[model samples]
Target: MAGMCCGFVGEGDSSANSRPSRRRNLDMLPFKYIADMTVAPSGTSRKRRQADLSGKKDFESCEGSNGDRGNEKSKKNKNESSKVSENKPSTEGNLEDGEFPKFGVTSVCGRRRDMEDSVSVQTSFYEELFHFFGVFDGHGCSHVATMCKERLHEILKEQINESQENFEWNSTMQQGFARMDDEVQRWNSSSQTVTCRCELQTPHCDAVGSTAVVAVVTPDKIIVSNCGDSRAVLCRNGVAIPLSFDHKPDRPDELIRVEAAGGRVIYWDGPRVLGVLAMSRAIGDNYLKPYVISEPEVTVTERRVEDECLILASDGLWDVVSNETACGVVRMCLKAHMMTSPAESPANNEVTTDGSDQACSDASILLTKLALARHSSDNVSVVVIDLRKDQRPTSNSNYNLIN
Candidate 1:
């Protein structure tokens, strides 16, 4: 797949200094929306002091033609708006309509410096037998995460276009990942300095990079591709089936790569890889590029009828919740609901659903909350995919894709 043309990196400024201004904009949008729905109080009103002190008065002027009744309605609206803003969508991409069974998905930012660094994508294509879900975790900075969020699907689409043959799944997935890495490198080279905002500039470009774990589900199988410590776990008949393995510095090849790149994997007192980062492979960390690059270890496996669910999460979630515990939560979510497709079943299992279909959304949100409760120090992100829909057969027979 061809990478998108790199954009120019604007003037240099510290992103840290500008973060508060950006967050303030995010905070004010909800406040304005609330105010537009309420009525304004008179200047001599007794509640003016209380309202000003609480900052709730900002929304009171939103009340319209209904007068005092509108004011009361606006009060309810303010409360509801507060609740909605507190509960943002778990995934990053826009939701798709009527593509799959709707599932409630929610996301709550954990106690971290940033609001969120996790992203997810769902798309319906090939008439609903294929589904794509990806979770990217930005560690040092969010550049890598943002790049993946924008380009992953485009890369896949390019690969599919280049390969006219049917279902060369493994090659397609590998090529897609390689293309993603190549794109990142290209991005790095094009910029004078790595920065997220076009208007901001910073001297330190070494700290930006992220971990990626992606899952592509077809009717007959599921393919998982991973880099860094982010993980993917599949639940079959309520049992945990680990699909991706963490790439740590301890692995002989990883150590070799690090050393080859003129970076040393220091073995201090412990056997820990490189004496610092536990993971051997990852997508970003320009400083570590000499020691180890972000080449992903890929795995492809056939799907079973009993396969119930899959969980893709960053280390933040895994650090707090065990693999078994995460699987249990997703399993419970599946059992609580019945699977219903938004469209008619294909004669063959060739159709797929988009990530924003809302089929597995709620479970994704709950998983994020669970990680937060565990007091995870880093940014937390999770993507849950339900495979029960694939287990059920329609008039068409299922076919596995292999190459």
Candidate 2:
């Protein structure tokens, strides 16, 4: 019922003569977990769920030595760590305005189902300049979303490292997501069998899952990977260029794949796999395994000078806000902020909050507000990354965002 918003802007030296700055806002909006996340044995049937759980014996009797207990403890600690990071707020006051330019992120919990959503922005992973951002929207429960938030980036980095000379960005992204799902599968299996008394209170672990839309901003490119309905849109020259597509069950390719897997695609509200999960791809939902996949579709795009910003958000925002409408609002705010205080000179090349930074941050907040105003039935989360690193407002602020 309560919602909070936080904004951060990465600032750096802006020079008109220097090659275009590598800065880009990678807005990773809301995500849904994998179809095979953690499955309740009877996910497809309410009657079966009751029947299966009632018949299954408790694994508590299987507990053995302190070594097993230690493993349980370690696993619990890992889950806790993930939770803390997912809930970590990137408030303006806490941001360090570090040396490397980074993204400004903002999020809001929509008045939809007890806020089964999690979001994260990490500027410290790997080399500091390589930033990652995402929004994970949980369904059935937030467990899978939280887990992905805590671990996906780390898994991605490890996979990239292991690939070494053979590193192909798209392949690495696909593989990273695959590995992340595998890790989640292992965790779920361990939790069921280990009989950890400490985790009895774990919430949102039923047949719950999440969708992921992630953006990694590197020195030369913006890499986006998406599973499920979440999305990423780049504002190039003020035009909306979608970086990822929603993986709805009815999408022709997705439908074919689901049917090929021996899964039925039936219309229930919207097209659903086996008339269960609405999405064709996700991070969790064990019953939907093989039908709902975790393989993320990846896009690698070069950074451009006319690139205004990037908007990443869950379907809640996209459901109500057209990509063009979202871009227009942000571009307008950025230009206005830059032009508002022409008399004051920028210190170094930084876009001071007193001017454009504040405007940009406000724009991020406005996007979240607009989604809520539209009464989106799903959780709404958004991140806005400023790509025009050094451009300050001049008399031409009114010019169209694109040539």
Candidate 3:
């Protein structure tokens, strides 16, 4: 028998760069003992084997040696199942990753009464640039804030989708606030009321309400909706652009609503719309429901590229810091510069060292510190959106967060 031989010589070989001409060579043998062979350079042997055996596998040996193979296959399957179970997303994952069941929120009760405040961020299309941040500050009880936290986004989406015309910014905002209030009342009416026996405690079932400030960021515009004392502000080029006005009971329009609702705006020390309530338009406070149903005065402004950031915070933050000071603090936080935490006591001029300047950092923590520093007596909550980095306009059709 004649054996086929293959070899390769490196460096000075002429065949290194040349393509070998195809030819057939054979070793003659008896028909019953016929065999076929092909020769290739040592470097090409592994490649040729890979190309020829792309799909075929050695099942015959495994079938014959079924004893060990069964145990091995069972172990592999069990390992894979465990891996899948391990990979299941946790509750915290849902919040942080913005998955189907969205997540990523942080709240502290602070040194106050029941933390009746709630905040959340929702991104439906997974476009990092499209985001919604909200702050709900509840009074009397936490129902209004809890409800808003759960359903505000759904209500807004429903209103937007039902409208045939392109959403006029103001009208859309008005409807969103109205819808939110309606939903909150509907929920309260359906549940069994709880009553507080203590005189100092707010009537548990009687009138619990909250102020809502929602900031919706789209590809072309940023829409802000507000009711009651809660406020939303956009920091543009280091200036505060007030997105919503505080609806004080003293305001002429608010006073008109208060009186019309059979509630007199009594001013003993100052203007009192509905006795002690400072704001005429707010969600919940069943006593104020009649006046609350009135549409919130809506204000819409086209967003400019220079609008660097937005802060949707409760009165707790505003009561301590002026709009100008708030803007300055946010700007410094965005630039990685130092700012005193709101938690520090201003009376003593004490400074806290936990303030963060990272763009992707949560603003609530810093806002809490600021509130503490300003000595805000009320519970403080803040929702900060870094517009420049969080919701940037994109040329691509897909949504993505700005880096």
Q: Return the top candidate by lDDT.
A: 2
The regions of model 1 sitting more than 4 angstroms off are 1-106, 125-128, 164-167, 191-206, 251-253, 260-262, 267-278, 338-359, 390-403
RMSD of 1: 17.1
**Order the candidates by lDDT, highest first — what do you get?**
2, 1, 3
2 against 3, candidate with superior lDDT? 2
lDDT of each: 0.51, 0.58, 0.49
**TM-score against native, each model:** 0.61, 0.68, 0.60
Summarize candidate 1's per-residue lDDT along 46-146 as a digit string, tens digits: 11111000011223111110000000011123233233222221111122212232222233334333432545444332212234566676654567777
Q: What value does the lDDT take at residue 68 in candidate 2?
A: 4
Cα lDDT tens digits for candidate 3, 41-104: 4663211211110011222110110000000011123233233222221112111122111111
Candidate 3 stretches with Cα past 4 Å from truth are 1-107, 125-129, 191-204, 260-262, 268-271, 337-357, 360-363, 389-403
Q: Between the candidate structures 2 and 3, which one is better when assessed by TM-score?
A: 2
Candidate 2 structure quality by residue, lDDT tens digits, 1-403: 0111110011011221233321121112222211111122533321111100010121211111000000001111323333322223211111222223324444444443234556665543543335676777667655677778778888987875576454577888899888878877767666454332211234324355788898886545678999988889999986899999989888999989999999988875556777667678888776578888999999988776677788788887887899999998888767665655545633224434322235545666677777767755565666677666545645754565423
User: Worst 10-residue stretch by lDDT in candidate 3?
Assistant: 62-71
TM-score of candidate 3 relative to the true fold: 0.60
